[model samples]
Target: MLYKVVSHMLEQEAVVEAQNSTQAKRKACRLWGVSPSDEWHGISTMQARKLTEKERRVAAVAIKHRNICLHTDEGGSTVSIRNTATALSVINQLIGTDTGYFG
Candidate 1:
């Protein structure tokens, strides 16, 4: 199963595959180059929780579709428009021209 592990001490988080929260914490600590024992000392400040089915599915879809791009150089670095009509409406708005069909 997939777990979302957050390290308050390091101000970082990761999604890891583990059997349980304990294992998730351990794996997260290893990935972050921290000691798992530090949790006892209140140093690691790690938390682990399982991802829900919906969250998992959404994540998978987002990764597969790449609907949003952050880098300008990557081409299509914009939110994807689903259909031709919607795309035309957006283009018209950007150009300050309202086509009657979309308006």
Candidate 2:
């Protein structure tokens, strides 16, 4: 599962995959290059919470859309689609549902 960890002292946040909050905090600290001693000393006040299902879905859609936008043509050039309808169609296909906004 994905968890969001926030460091109140550093005013920073990170998303990590962990089994629980303790693991999430450890992963986030490692990602930020923070030492365990610093965390214990309250140098980087950290809190970890799991991401909701909706948030996870949104994140997945965003990643997939980014990959779609970065797709390249046969000539090694990036293909850009400027049509809103086409974009909506792609999004609907990725999420496996029609959101009704583009209907």
Candidate 3:
């Protein structure tokens, strides 16, 4: 499928440029003749490895509340779980990490 081809190109770019995941994605776009304005809806496992620092920060913040919930007003346990779920959803939306591993 298209995903497999793009993924292979991305990996090749990574090996060629010695770049990380994010860079490889950009490279793949170029290889596929995709413009920067193009909207990408999925993130392969490679992309997850390349997540930008900003995304990583957001994901971390999203997950942090879960730990906080363990100590503070544990009464809001549902709220904490909700936030984490929302965070996971956002991450999945932005980058397809195939979090099925969590299950």
CA lDDT, candidate 3, residue 90: 42
Q: What lDDT would each prediction earn against the true structure?
A: 0.56, 0.56, 0.39
Give candidate 2 regions above 4 Å deviation.
39-44, 63-103
Look at candidate 1 and give me any clashing residue pairs. none
Best first by TM-score, ranked:
2, 1, 3
Candidate 3 Cα errors over 4 Å, as ranges: 1-49, 67-86, 94-103
lDDT per residue for candidate 3 within 36-77, as digits (tens), equals 344442234234243345544545665675432212333333
lDDT (Cα, tens digit) per residue for candidate 1, span 10-75: 766666667998898887777667787875423247777877676455444444464433333444
| Model 2 agreement with the true structure over 1-64: per-residue lDDT tens digits | 7666777676666666679888878876776688756845232478877776775665455444
Point out where model 1 deviates above 4 Å: 39-44, 61-103
Report the CA-based lDDT of candidate 3 relative to the real structure: 0.39
Worst 10 residues of 1 by lDDT: 94-103
Q: How many backbone clashes does candidate 3 have?
A: 1
